[model samples]
Target: MKLKKPIASLVSVVLLSIGMATLVTSPASAHTNAVSATCSALSVDLQLYAASREGSPAEGYTEYQWTRTVVDNAAWTEYVRYTYTPKKHGKADPADASSTPLTDPSHWNADNKTYDNSAVDTYIHSGNGEGSWFWWIATTHEAKTHLETKWSKNEPAGDGWVKTGDSRFHETSPAVEAKTNHVAVTIDGTKVENTDFSTTFTKNYPFSDKYTSHTYSVVVTAWDDPMGTHGWTFTKSGSSIACTPPVVQVTAVFPEPVAPTCTTDGALPSLPTDQTGITFSWDENNSLKMVANADKGYVLTGATFNIYEKPGTATGDCYVPLEPVTVAPQTCQVGDGGVADFSGGSITLPTIAGVTYTVKTSGGEPVTITDGKATGLAPGDYTVTALPAEGKILTAGETGWKVGEDGSATITVTVGASADCSVVQPDSKVTSTEWADGTWACDATTVKQTREVTTTPYIWVDGAWVLDTAKAATVTEKQTRDLLASERTVCTEVLAAPPNTVVTIVPPTCTADGSATLANGVGYTWDKTSFGPGLWTATATVADGYAFDNGSTYQVTFLVSPKLTGGACSVSQVLAAPPNSGTFSQVLAAAPNASTAAVLAATGATPLPLAIVAMVLIGAGVVLQPRVRRAIFTRH
Candidate 1:
């Protein structure tokens, strides 16, 4: 018979028992009591074994036996009682049941149900009519059980589960290894041991096989397990792999600055031959090296420095030679000290000589050759000299020439003033001779003189001879007294004459007291002091021999004046007096009577008035006398 153990609680056992079994001989004698009924029948094998072997017919039967060997009585006090309930009914006939041996404990506990086998070691009991009775067993042996608990299942309803008391029969679990780089594994069943495997094992195992294939989940949590303490979880799959960090590269870029070029024109500077260096500065900020080339030369826009030739070095071409004069004159004497003479005897000076020269006069005026003219000579001397044009000097064979035996002389021929002879005569006596008495004699003769005047001559005064007049007649002394006496007698006679007398006396023509008298008349003197003419009182004197007429009833006349009249007279003639005197009454008493006067006057009368008076008498007689006669006859 096959006996099955409950996979949840009971274990199965297998054992070998030796026993004698008799064969029943057919037709043989009667059997003795010792000849027991040899029951070589199959029995149920029962011992403590893993319940996983129950009901595995292919694994065959298992014999199990138990001995009460007390190793630890204290641990054995609480026994573990295992009971099995079979699902099938037990058969009454043992010959009809089948048996098989169980081999592996892994197959015995695999199923959750129990199986039945016809075995004497197992008791059967029924639970009313609910199910069939299988087996029940109680043992007092040391429990070989282990318990494993995860901290996640310490409290079943909360996050944990616990196995204690009757739950000690649970299966043991394998140990779980703890690791640093992977998920921690924990055993949950009894008889478990913690293993410290490598983290590589945790990575290889990933998760329990109940989860997805090729992809697994691990309990990565903070918990107290038999393995370790900490919390972590790693979920992995077939395609998951670790990634490497990326690589990077960095680079730097820089910019370059540009330099400037020189473009200055016409900037040649004067430098010393020994100059050491030249540094050029730019308007902008830059630094550059100067490279000299045959075509481009040196750049000067930016800064460029140069080291030059030394101070005393000679360079470049020499200066040009001085230009030559175009037209130079020949060598000639110049200035005032040098003398130039005419080569020939009749040389003339040039009209436009440019230089100065000394012109010496040999036998003529001292002439100076200046402004092309010979000056400073008198009129007579310069009349033979000539002059050149302005600004020229006398040269040899030019303006003038030298005569024979003369040295360097120029002849200036010019007009001169005339000679003056009026200065030769001075103010001296000039006489004229007349031939009187047939001899050469000088008498005073009147000669008219004139003046001779000139700007160049001395002054001349009048110096001619003059003549004198001859003297007149002289009177005698005896004749002069006779004439004076006759004049006195005539004056006395004239004084004695009376009023109304006419007396006439001739003047005495004689001399008195050395005075001359007249010869042609008498001398008479009168002083009619208080009376009219011909009535005189005698205060008259006359020359001797002159008579006085007094009371004679005659006219008196005296002569004391000159006889000359009505003409120019000389100084001696105008001063002479007449010698005659006459009475005024006698001249008045000699008048003729009227009728006799008319006859004598008729001989000397004017006929113009007589003729006019005769014409008026004739007209009046003819016009008025006849008118009067006619008027009278009418009246009668």
Candidate 2:
């Protein structure tokens, strides 16, 4: 008969009994008080582990030791000592339970339960229950009584398996061995303490056979409440990880942790690459600083930045500083340089704060002062120079200054300007022209602004603001009328040779100063006096600042046709009477365009041209002929 004890699944238990068991046969005829019995075999196994085992991890690891024998004392005595290393996260597995047996104590002693089979069974099972179930555990007196009462009843060894007490195959010891591991829990890298952790587990015990295992259950829980939302999971292994193990190990494995997430805000847009964490410093009154912290194993990444007049944060009035800040420093001012205030007072610059200027001493290094103001300046002579912007000049401060005993002194520079000048233009009286009402009839005359006053010349440069040396003149200046071209009036015919006609000529004129302006001088010359024949035109030209009053004119007409006459004429006396004298100096001129032949014909000279008639008259009268032939046929 055998009792059972739970087996620790984390450890592999194996028990080997090496000592020989003595076989005692019931003597053919037992003495009235003698007894003897024979046994078959004996063994024990132990496999145990703590809550934290291989493939299992918690706060830390735990250690265990086994100091017991795995051999029977009534049979052979032998034992092994072993120790289990603490679980190192997932690396938690103890060596197998193996021991060398030796015949050390072969006697039975139930009084002490030591140096016996009970010790061996206890060592193998981590407890006496399961191991003892498979061991020969009866007391010395019970063993003798059991052999006499059941197997020694005159039964021989050859008798077909007679009842030997209640037939038994195994027995067990009383000692129980157990182990425990520390319960630990953690999240990320932080430990979880002060919390009870547990897990439900079953410990199987040994069978009725000497070498089998027994089982029971022990519940343990491991948990970590770090940042409750850290999100963690727990699982058991070595049993049903993916498949069930023939011998359960009850291993608890915790997978690698997922880094916890921490959302950050108010970080700088542009962070340096090397520095993943941020630290800031500034005065809240004027400026702000922002920084960012990268997650573990990462560095700050760089980013672009955009400047703005104000932060466009949605938290309206809520302002949180990401870093410390500092404010700008204050400064004092003395004066500025510009156009000297020539207002009779001290010609000096004005005061302005925080403006920079460079002060250069003759031989010393240059020093910069703000607002042209300096306090506790090294005593010496120095020339203050203005570092004005480009395109600007030091208009107000250009002289070197001596540094007086006064520790506080000022210098300034100025900018901006302009100048003015005046000159007089000579004024001349503008003449009012009395122009006759013009008639536009083909032959009628038309008049215009025929003459203009000339501008006066002055000793001055072009574009210069000249100062007038004398008063401007106000007088009627006569215009110089120069004849530039001439034209004549055409007469058709006035006898053969006509008298010259005197015309009223009006010359085109301009001011004398026009020569300064016009490359071509101005004026028009036309023949208002000389009147004659065929064709004519009035031409005009101009100097600078002047133009012609009128353009060139078209052709005029001239004719030599004559007219008939019957009344008395100027040359009638000479014609009626022949010239009695030696000579007649003149002949009568004909009216313009009249036919002289027709006129003489009307005088009854002849029906021929005047030249032929004159020839006939001279012949008749000089030779004192009786009559002129051309007149002979007339009705005188």
Candidate 3:
């Protein structure tokens, strides 16, 4: 009997990553440029650290826990996020008061979104309330919150929490202890009436969303004092040393889904997962065959499914005789005297089910049926179709029997069976393009490029032969991995670089240059600064095991070039080398800065000798000086 409601449909995922968005948990970063020039009057540099509370639910339980808190330094860090730009001597003119620089010898200011310690950041646990008393108490039914904040003029609060650290407020706080040791009541640079008295921060719970997936922005604060007792001794630029506070963001993800459960309830147990038991194996005749898991006692309803298919592409027509008298069994051809293959090339195997056979007359001649089955037939020739209780119908080929044939005429079927499909490639490469175990290769018999395994599987369960997708056999997969072909001795292509720079690449060729090559990373440069314009190339003297595609050769190309007398190039111009390796009209063969006479008299053997060229140009210019022309013109 079919289930009243499909179990698969009833199963729903409450929490979905449909849109797994990120919640910024950390505070907007604070910037500070504040460090007192001298510590003479600086009271102390105190660092207060606090942890952001984190909670998680126990597996399979509804209650959640505040396992531990991650420390958040930003709570106290924001107060002194002053940019410390010290004055030449003491402090800037508007020191500690104005944000910008002033000429005042000992003055400064801290602006730029400075923190206001005067007011408490009440909404520190903004939006999220996991650690808030309201949220925690709601779940635990507690009368009061265990967490506390307070200040005191008494000695350090020591190990135990102070119920009432000070008359200022009856609360538990870190600053309760530090106030005891000091002679003067001083926290940060602000002095208290008594060295004993110090103030602290307390929080009032704000309303938040009910517990669920959320981004909680909570800032916890803890105090660290040189006294090392307790209570906060917060300080600023005027009283503290230079320090940087780190900002960290924390995010929470929904827990994983619960595993499937099995119970004695009327509902069917979960179906077999992953087509582990369904398989197929071809008999000698290549007729349809299936190997699968039996339903045994687990099946509530019996399983019966049909397999339908046509001949494979290789076979033009599907026809396999039950007894091949005329043709060899192994080499039977399609359209021979046998049952033809299924219609769609392959059988559509459903969950395991019985395949029953019935013999009916080829043509429609009213035949009597008994007990909902074919019986008592005086047959001439009849067609037998394998009617699977579930999927498709399998052809049993045509049969001609005597009027009084025995049960041999009865249908044969395996109660529970799915598609059987899996193949094994030959250990070595083969010339065959398509083999039973699907493997597609490169060369006719050289390399195997890809291999695959495909199948459809089913397992018997809950009595009925329903589609066992979970038990379906794994489909075939094709994969091509790392291939080994020696690297060719060639450059792949030119790369981009800075102005006036070019690169040449040499592959670690297979067997051409032996091992004389460098380790693939060493680069060589040709100095052309003083040598006038000419071709320049950089080569590597190292060799590495990296391989290249196709047959390439040692190659050189320009990547960067600068100021071209004419042409579009990337790198800055190298005076000596030709901009690129091609012949062109009026290309500067030599450095343009070279002397004019040097170009006129330049030879391939040598560029103009630097010393000689300079002297020659200076001496020639003196003789051509125009002042001498005045005397000559006057004589003429």
Candidate 4:
């Protein structure tokens, strides 16, 4: 019979000898001295067959040599039918049990004269269980015994399956294998140091099962964080990513960074051709930096830049995003050997002839402009103007221009100066002559006269010459005169008579000088000191005369006393006294001699008788005049 083994001890067996008459029998003989005894021992023994096996459990794998047996000490050999039962024991009867021959039979023990079958039920036990086997034995008599065997304390195979996927990536529900991956173990709710725990899971497989993919991608990546509203981000491959526990992947994607293009708010004259033409990077303050490549003699002016996020990108490890800012525009002249780092590649500024402007009588602030259009302007009648630069002029459009409501106006500026204007004048000449005032000549021949002349004046107006009537003087004349020699007045102090005729002699007086007789004797004595010692002049007219004309006038000049000689009574005239005629001369001759008259008159006698006697003596031609005068003087 098969026996059962306990958990902590060896198996207990209950053996009975079976006596069946209607079954196949071995022998039917009994001895009188032999007592009827039942089989009492039934046991199961275990032995280790192999320590390890293929496809074993992750915790531990084992194999063992197993044996089951039943034995009795009596010297009777019999046939028994044994049956294995998982639940019941000792119910098999020899009348109904199958009498199949054993694959391995019992052997006889010579020392004890006993029989035992230890190899009756032999199999590999992979798990722990409780089992039993029943047996029916036929002895040499009619008595029967039934036996039951049970066994326990067999070990189980494994805990469960385990996982063996890649460790670089994590999944929510992971794949596993038996006892190959670290599994958490916990007493209550707390975990322990249990990485070696495992389970038997059928879904665990290799990681390359999903690696074959199709897409257009590159190793280079771009990062962005516009205004730094969010953290840095970069675009990754659709087949690759990073993760934490409970998930894992093996393929690594290393992407290089691509250069971003430079941008501006205003329009540029040229654009970059490639990445090298304009490069965007970071500065020492982690700000965005842009550098450009420019040609010779080119310059950058009035260009500004700001940071912008590259769209549709995820942050990579090597890239960082910066805050948004607008970089101030810079001016760099490549011709002056300066760097074009502040500009984009190949910058060409728009040409503006004149940029200065003004608002005519408008007090508003200057308006901002974009592409020559005024912006932020209020609605009004705005007169927009374009002012010229230094050393230039508004030669064409000097007048103010009006702008439409849309602030649209065309300002044409010309750069130049205005024209010039000047002149020269003429010389003066003589015109006429006239007589001078307050002059003596003929009667009205020294009269005053008038001369006349003319002149014209001009002025300049609006680049041309015109008559200046307001400043022009009227026709004017000047007065002057010329003197004549015949007009000079002559003055005479004394008049002398002709010599040798009878005349009366005027004796010298106290206030007058004496005068001598002339041929036309006239008694004329004058005071010489009346006029000063100088040339005296007077206009002379002829006195009334018998024959000479008296209507004409002439000039006479007299040399007064001391001017003529040293004598006080001396005088001279440049012209003779007027009125000299033959009758006037005869009158002078009729006069007696002034010396004779003076001699007779000084005698103080009767002049008629004496004069008659003197005349008879003078007429008697020979009478000595001195003798006659002596007689007369003696007689007196």
Query: How many clashes in each candidate?
Result: 115, 72, 74, 56
Tens digits of per-residue lDDT for model 3 on 1-636?
A: 366356534443212222222122121111111212222222222122332233343332122112222333323232422233433533233323332223322322334444544333122221233321100000122233244343444433444444442244333432322212222223333443232212222222211222111121212123223432333322222222222222333221112222322211122122233432222233344333222332322222222222223322331222222310111111112222222222211112222234443444557454443443443333134444334433222333553311112223222221122232222222322222332222322222222343344343333344323344564444334444433343112232221221111122111111111011111222333333243322333332212322223221232222111123324444332233212222110112333354434433432223321111111122211211111000111100
User: Tens digit of lDDT per residue, candidate 2, span 137-192?
Assistant: 33232111112233233344443334434333222333332223222322222333
TM-score per candidate = 0.12, 0.15, 0.12, 0.16
The prediction achieving the highest TM-score against the true structure is 4
Write candidate 1's Cα lDDT for 545-572 as tens digits. 3333422223333222212223342322
Worst lDDT run of 10 residues, candidate 1, spans 627-636
Candidates ranked, most accurate by TM-score first: 4, 2, 1, 3
Error of 1 at 113 (Å): 99
Query: lDDT, candidate 1, residue 30?
Result: 22
Off by over 4 Å in 1: 1-350, 354-357, 360-365, 382-415, 418-499, 502-636
Clash count, predicted structure 1? 115
Error of 2 at 363 (Å): 32
- Candidate 4 lDDT over residue span 1-636, tens digit each: 143345223422221223343222322111001111112211111111111112432342223322333233435546444544333344422222232324322321112212355343233111133433334344454334433232222422333222222122223343433222222222213333233212211111112212222221111110112222221112212222212222222221112234332221222122234432233233345233333433223333333233323432322222111111111222323322222222311111122353344432145455454554443333333334544343333332333333334333323222122122123222232233442244443333333445555444555554335566566554556554543555443432222211112222222222222221222212222222122223333333323321112223433332222212245635432211112223212111111223334433433322221111111112211222111000111100
The runs of at least 3 residues in candidate 2 whose Cα sits more than 4 Å from the true structure, single-residue gaps closed, are 1-275, 278-294, 299-403, 412-417, 421-636
Model 1 residue 593 lDDT score:
23
Off by over 4 Å in 3: 1-454, 460-466, 473-476, 479-492, 498-636
Candidates by lDDT, descending order: 4, 3, 2, 1
- Model 2, C-alpha of 522: deviation from truth (Å): 47
Candidates 2 and 4 compared: the better one by TM-score is 4
**lDDT at residue 160 of model 1 (Cα atoms):** 23
